[model samples]
Every structure is written in structure tokens, then in C-alpha cells.
Target: MSAAAEDEREEQYAFPMPPAGGWTADDLDRIPGLPPHTELIDGGLFFMSPQTDFHMATLRLLEFALVSAAPEDLYVVREMTTKLAKRDRPEPDLMVVPRKARTSREQTWYDPSDIILAVEIISDDSVERDREIKPRKYAGARIPHFWRVEKSNGLPVVYVYELDPATHTYAITGIHHDRLKLAVPFPLDIDLTEI
Candidate 1:
């Protein structure tokens, strides 16, 4: 591409400037031209990177497995944000939320209490947010369960966590290499190798 054309394209897609105190969760809805799956964390906007083959495959596998195993009362959603606070809204890769939480088809976010489990699949660019920042925020919000899926030798390794209500923190419950079997947040058995 010619330098002039490239410059024009960049000008067309310039990043949005944040407000004085940074962006609130509600700003996400009003912001135009923002990338899809944009998140608000600590009053800042986070744009997502392109999805990889491994990320897409693993997300599909987990969604299928969870949807099939979840009880009638629960619903599984992908890339939906849970509002933890006024300035904090982060989209989990997959979430198991109560069916009753769906107030309307137009609803774009869920309350932290409504989410039973939040899963994040790690990516090269998302290592810090997926592994540390998001988990801390989720735990602080008292989300019951959190799962971090990491790539290991071209396969997946699931690290499961359960919230400690007293301390408002997450405790590592189990790390499943081949199969993920859990009792809390409903009975679930998934084969990690399928990813």
C-alpha cells in the first residue's frame, strides 16, 4: 500500500480519547467505531485482538460442553460482560449465568451475582489480563468460579478456582490436564483434550 493510503486508513480508525476520569462501563455502549468485544476495566477501554485458531476451537468446545451439561436453570453465553462496578466491566470468554438474569434480548451485560462461572482462554497478547487482572476483579466481585485455560504443548491445561467468600478471594481448586471434573456451580465433566 502507498504511504498516503496507509496514513489515510490510520486516520480513519484513530483510537477514541478517554474522558477526564477515564471511561465508565456505560461509555462502552455509547462509544461508536470501537472494536467488537471491547471491555471496560478500571475506567479504561480494552480492545480485543484477532482470535487465533486455538482460541476459537477451544471456546467452541467449551461452549458446547457446558451448554450440553448445564441444568435447565442455567444459560451459557460467550463474550458477554459482567458489570462488577461502575467502572469495571470485563467480558469473559464464556460464562455460566442463571437463566433468570436475562431481563431482555437487548441486555448487554450481567450482574456479577448472576454469573456462576467465568472462563478465560489465554492468548499471547492477553496473558496479563487473563491470568492476573481479570481474575482479581472477578474474585473481588464475588463471582463463584473462575477458570483459566492455558496452552501447553499445543493442548489445553485448565486451572480452576473457587471463590472464598470470607476473604473475597479465589482459591485454586484444581488443575485439570486431560479432563475437567467439577462439582460446584453444577456438576460438569469436560475433556480438555478435545480442545
Candidate 2:
């Protein structure tokens, strides 16, 4: 392929950037079909690469594990946006919220207070955000739990964090590579290797 053609293709897959001053969460809604794999972060638009097969499998596994352990009144959802502020609406890979709670008449976003857990499956496209920006934001919003799932040497590594009310930050509670056992948000266990 020609160099120019290759460059163009690279640009096509790159994340779209908003004009100066950035874009708000509302601006993202103006697009038709509400295109997937995009998010508004700190008032800016970021496009994410699609998950790999293994990543999707791990996500499904964790979702099932969380759902099976949560109480009947709680809901386990994937890719639902949480309105942290006027400019911030992040859709976690998985989230746990109250079953009866509705964030809006349209049921598009959830109120931050309603979220009990937020999970992000790390990918090459989202390393920084998943490791730093998101946890900081989730903590700032006072979300109770934040879990980061990362692939290290081809295996999924789960890091669990719980919010520290006094500091408004997440403290690492557990890190698991094989079996994941946790008591918070109710007891949960999973064989990570199977996924």
C-alpha cells in the first residue's frame, strides 16, 4: 500500500477529537445511533478500539460472576453511562446499580449515587484512562467500588478497589490472577483461568 494511503487508513481508526474547548456529554448525543465505542471524558471525545475475543470473554465472565452474587435488588449492567457531571458521562464495561433506580425518563444514564461498582476491562486503547483517569473520576464521584481487569502476559489480572470515605480515593483491596474471591457488594468467587 502507498504511504499516503496507509496514513489515511491510520487516521480513520484514530480517536476523533473535538474542536477547541472540547465536547460535552450532550454534544455526543447529537450523533445518530449514538455510535458505540466512544465516550466523553473530562469534556472531550475519545474513540475506543473494539475489544478482542479474549477481552470480551473475560468481560462476560466477570459480569456473570458479579450478577450471580449481587442481591435481588441490585442490577448488573454492561456499557451503561453514568452521569458524573454535566461534561462527564462514562460507560463502564460493567456496572452494578440498584434494580429499581432510573437515572432518567429515557433510562439512558445512571446517577452516580446509584452505582455501587464500576468495572473496566483494560485494553491497549484504554490503558491510561482505565488505570488513572477513570479510577480518579469514579472515586471523585464517590462510587463505592472500582475494579480494573488487565491482561498481563496473556492472563487476566483483576484489581479491586474500595473507596476510602475520608480521602475520597480508592484503596486497593485485592488483586487476583486466578481465583477471585471477594466479600464486598456481597460474596463473589470466580475461576479466572476458565474465562
Candidate 3:
């Protein structure tokens, strides 16, 4: 195709412009042609890049482990946004929420209070957000528990953090490289090598 023709075609498929105050959390559901796992943070929309094999394998391993270990009252979910504020709705790679918090099958997001644990598996494109930004936001929202998984030597390294309610910050609890054995957020004994 000619350069001019391609430019015109691209303009026709351009994403919607943000409203006066940028995009709201609710706007995520209404936006058309948005790629899957789109998030709203501080009134701005963030689109996720395609997943890698490392990201996918780690996510699947954690999700399966969490689901198997979670109590009957807690539910495991993947790629579901958590509503932290009007403009801050982030989709953790995997989340453990209260079974009762699920309002309906159509529910797109969960309240932060309903989430017991939020896990983010680091991806090349999301290193900064997973390592810093999202953890700060989740801690501020007092989500209780957060786990960040990083790929090292072709293996998953899990960094666990517990929210400090008084300071609204996260305190590092443990960093598990091989076996993930945790007492809080339910008893979890996962073999990271499986990923």
C-alpha cells in the first residue's frame, strides 16, 4: 500500500481519544477495539503487550497452585481488573478474591477489599509497572498481599510483600527462588521449577 493510503487507513482505525479528564475505570468496558487486558491508572489507559512464554508459563503455574491451595471461600482469577479508585483499575496477572465478591459472570472488576492476594508475573514490557508502580498502588489500596514474579535463569523468582496498613506501604516478607512456601494468603507450597 502507498504511504499516504496506509496513513489514511490507520487514522480510520485509531483508538478513541481520552475524555476531558482522561479515561475513567468504567470507560475501560465501554471502549471499542481495545486490546484485551487494558487497564486504567490515574485516569490514563494502558494497553498490555502480547505475552511471552515465560510470562504465560509462570502465570499458569501460579494460578494453578493458588487455586489448588486457596480456601473454599476464596477464588482464583486471571486477568481481571481490580477497582482501586475511580481512575485506578489494574488487572493483576492473577488474583485471589473472596468467592462472595463475584457479583455476576459479567462482572469485569473486583473491589480491592475483596481481593486477598494479587500476583504479577514480570514481563519485559511491564518490568517497571510490575516492579514499582502497581505494587505502590496495590499497597496504598491496602490489598493485604502482593506477589511479584521475576524470571531468572529461566526460572520464576517470587517476591512476596505484605501491606502495612498503618503506612499504606508494602513490607517485603519473603523472596522465594525455588519453592514458594507461604503461610499467609492461605498456605501455598508451590515448586517454581515447574514453570
Candidate 4:
């Protein structure tokens, strides 16, 4: 293109693309709190899609199961923004921090190393992000286990991710059916029907 054409084209798109920058932990502090189940993405804050009755029920049931299987000492945080780095603190649906780390009073943020497992419940708003995006970030941090729940197909599917001893990245171990009859993550062995 000619110089004049190039200049005109550049002028036509003078405005910058939005959500343009990475978000830092300090930026997380600056943003106002949103209502429950909401999250920050890119550099903007937005609510996680309104949850369905089944979704809420599922989460509640899972919480109860975890509480029963695991002792009270393991601090479980719901919807907490774990400070992983200057730019990322994933609020996994459920995370269990070691009892000692949880008791530590010198911390300004939750350390990634303290987290044993990270769980995410996927809705329409988070399917792609939970499945495709979070693994890369979480695996990079060497989180031992990750779980994903989705109801998109009208079936309560579960995906379990674990780190292979030989590889740091996560690989799927098993996929569970929607039925409330199976249990794999030990101690969490209560039947789905029981929940």
C-alpha cells in the first residue's frame, strides 16, 4: 500500500484494543468486590454466570463430602483468590490448604504450595476457561490435582487431572458418569445418592 493509504488505515484504528494489559495482584486489590460467584478475567471484573439449582446443589453436596472425608484441620476455602503471582490468583471452586499453612499468621496471600487440590464447577460462562485455560496455568504452578465439573450435556460429568510423576503437566486419569453412584477420590467415597 502507498504511504498515504497506510497512514489512513492506521488513523482509522487509533483506538486501542481493550482488556489490553495483564492484571497484577495489586490491580486485584484496586477493583471493587463484585457479588458472589463473580471473577476477574483479563483486566476486567465480571460475575460468573448465575448458577443453576442443580449446580448449587452439587457444590453444596461436594462441600459436605469434603468436610466429612477430610478433617476440620485442612482449611478449605470457597471462592478464594489464591495469590500465585503478580498477575494470577485463580479462585478455584474449592481448594484445600494444609492445616499448618492455614494456621500461619505471617501471610498476606495464600501460597500455591499449600493447596492440595483445586476444583472447578463449569457453567456456560466457564467451560472453555475451566477446561482449556486453567490447566495450563495451574499445571505451570505444579498443583498436584485438579478437578472439573460440567453439566452442559445435561449430565453431571467429572474430569480428574493428576500430575504424572514423570511429567509436570496434568493428564486425565478418569471420567465419571453423571450418576450419583461412583466414587474415586478416596475418603470422598460416599455414594452420590448419599449426597
Candidate 5:
């Protein structure tokens, strides 16, 4: 492309570039009505497509179960953004957080330390990202627990992991198909097929 055309194209794009230092979590507030599925990773925005009915169904069921099992001081939320760093904010499919930490309804994202558990329900479009990139980011942020849900033969398979602070990675705790029971982040028991 010619320099003039390139300049014209750039001018037509109204969105301003991030400052030299990069974007911070505070920058997200400036974007009015940001889509619930949008996430910020290392200063770039990634938009996830709408989930399938089965995926949503699984997520809602899991959220309900977690909330029911959670203690009064802790609760579960769906698609809440977590501020992992100045340039990284990820919206896990569901999260369990302390009620005290979530008292500030004005905040767009929660601090990673406030999050006790992060869950992701995978679909065709997000299989690799949910399985790989997100776990690394969540573990690096020191979130204590992570759960990934995968569908196998039309059943939900739950993969649970706990952070290993020594290595700053996650260690597999358990994988459940028919039922899920975990002691950490409080005792959670859920029937996979119920969803």
C-alpha cells in the first residue's frame, strides 16, 4: 500500500492506541459497555464468540452448585473480570470469591488475591485457550484453585488443579466425570449429569 493510503486507513480507524507504557486495568473502565466476553491479555483485547447452549447450560449448573456449596462468606459469580496485572484482565467462566472482596460493586475487575477459585467451561472455539493460556495466567497470578470443564461423550469432565507456589504452576488435584468433590476452596460436591 502507498504511504498516503496507509495514512488514510490509519486515520479512519478511530480507536486510539495504548500509551507507550501499555494499558492498565483502569483503562478498561473507559470503554463503555465492553462486551462480557472480551478479555485483555498483555495489553491486547481478545473477543470470544458466544458460547453454545450446552456450554452455557454447563456453566450455569456449575455456578449454581458452587454457590450452593460455598460458605456464606464466599460466593460464586459468572464471567467476572479479574485484574491479574496492569495489562492483563481475564474473565473466567465462573469464579468463587470472598464476599468482603466483592463489596465494591463499582469496580470493573477483582484483584487476583480476592479470587479463591477460577473456573472455565470449554467449547469448540475456546478449547486450546481455556486448556493452556488461561491456566498459565491464572496460576501465575497465584489464584489458589482452577477448574476446567470439558465435554466427553456429552458428559462434563471436571479437571481440578491447585497452585504450587514453589513452582508458580498448577498441580492436578482431581478429575471428575460423574461427580465432583473437592476439599480445597471449601468442600464442593456436585453431580456432573445434573446440568
Candidate 6:
């Protein structure tokens, strides 16, 4: 058949939910009606948050800026599954993983060892979950850095966490107003206002 038709098969993992409870990675593979892509997080299932016009526009601009500003080798992805060992697996809103990292080709799930920075862009319904639960999980995974973004009120708050040298654990180190500045994991000169 055609290459596009073959490509479609690899991406489909549509499964219906049972009454309640968590799903194993195997269950994820069995989903029969899943949309284009998805990520499993915190023992719960979520379709990637629907993108609003502003959010989509903002993300596209930011994606282009980050790629141009970083090393030619850097990669950016949205709603990527990151394996947090057997206890949990999370797909944050945006993740800057190594160049050419492949989800489908993986021998094992994406682990803390593979990530540089993990990010969460808060939607109106998810502030508490992003600030409290998810960051703790990222810290536990010992992922070197975590970023949290808030894009609601005219200005969005962005926080960055770097592995703290003393504790050898992730700690909040910088706060960049997403509006005032598209702070970090970015080329230093690209201005948010330009987007």
C-alpha cells in the first residue's frame, strides 16, 4: 500500500475506558479508538489538551523560536510520554528531548535518563495538578529540569527548576514571566514580544 497508509497503522492506539482504575502500558497499546496521539500520566488517561487558537499560535511561534535558538541538534515535542519507572508515566505539555528520539522505536519506555527539560503548560482546569503533583513526580524522577507555565491572565508565569547541587534533586531556580520573557530552554536573545 502507500507510505501514508502504512504510517497510519503505527500511530493508532485507540482503546475505550473501563469503568475505573489504571491501565498498564499493554492496555494503552490495545486502545482501538484513540485520537491521533496521547500520553498516559499519573495512572490516569488524558487526551492532549485541546489547543485553543491563542495557545496553538503561541506554541507554534515558541517552537520555531526555541529550535532556531538552541543547538541544531536539539528537539522539541508536545505530549510526549516519559516513563517514570513502574509507578508512573507522564506526558507533559512540552518536552525537549534528545534529537531524533523515537517513541515507537524504543526498547523501553522513555525514562528520566533521556530527558533534559520537562515542561507543563497549565490550562485553566489544571493549575493545582501541575504545580503540586506533577512537579513532585518530575523531581522524584530526578529529571534535571522542570518548567511550569501559566498562560491565562494577560501574562503567563513560567518557572524553571534545575537539579540542585546540594540535594542532588530538582529545585526551583528561576521564574520568567512568559509574557515579559519567553524565559529559557531557549536561545538567550529571542524575545517573547517578537512572537
Give the alpha carbon lDDT tens digit for every residue of 98-131 in model 2: 9888545567777889899999999888889889
lDDT of 5 at 112: 92
Model 4 lDDT, residue 142, Cα: 77
Which stretches in model 3 have alpha-carbon errors above 4 Å? none
- C-alpha RMSD values across all candidates: 1.5, 3.3, 1.3, 8.0, 3.9, 8.1
Q: Give candidate 1's whole-model lDDT.
A: 0.91
Alpha-carbon deviation at 99 in model 6, angstroms: 2.0
Task: Estimate every model's Cα lDDT from 0 to 1.
Answer: 0.91, 0.86, 0.91, 0.67, 0.85, 0.64
Provide TM-scores for the models: 0.95, 0.86, 0.96, 0.74, 0.86, 0.72
Deviating ranges (above 4 Å) for candidate 1:
1-7
Please give the lDDT score at residue 82 for candidate 4. Answer: 67
Ranking of models by TM-score: 3, 1, 2, 5, 4, 6
Best by TM-score: 3
Clashing pairs in 5: none
Poorly placed runs, candidate 4 (over 4 Å) = 1-22, 33-38, 41-46, 103-109, 152-155, 178-186, 193-195
**Which residue window of length 10 is worst by lDDT in model 1?**
186-195
| Pairs of colliding residues, candidate 3 | none
Query: What's the C-alpha lDDT at position 30 in model 4?
Result: 49
User: How do the residues 1-195 of candidate 6 rate in per-residue lDDT, one tens digit apiece?
Assistant: 899887787556435655356665445556667664455565666666566655565566556655666666667766556777553666676677777565575433455776777878776656677788778878777777787766645444567788775676667776765433434555444344443
Clashes of 4: 0
Instruction: Compute the lDDT of residue 12 as modeled in candidate 6.
Output: 65
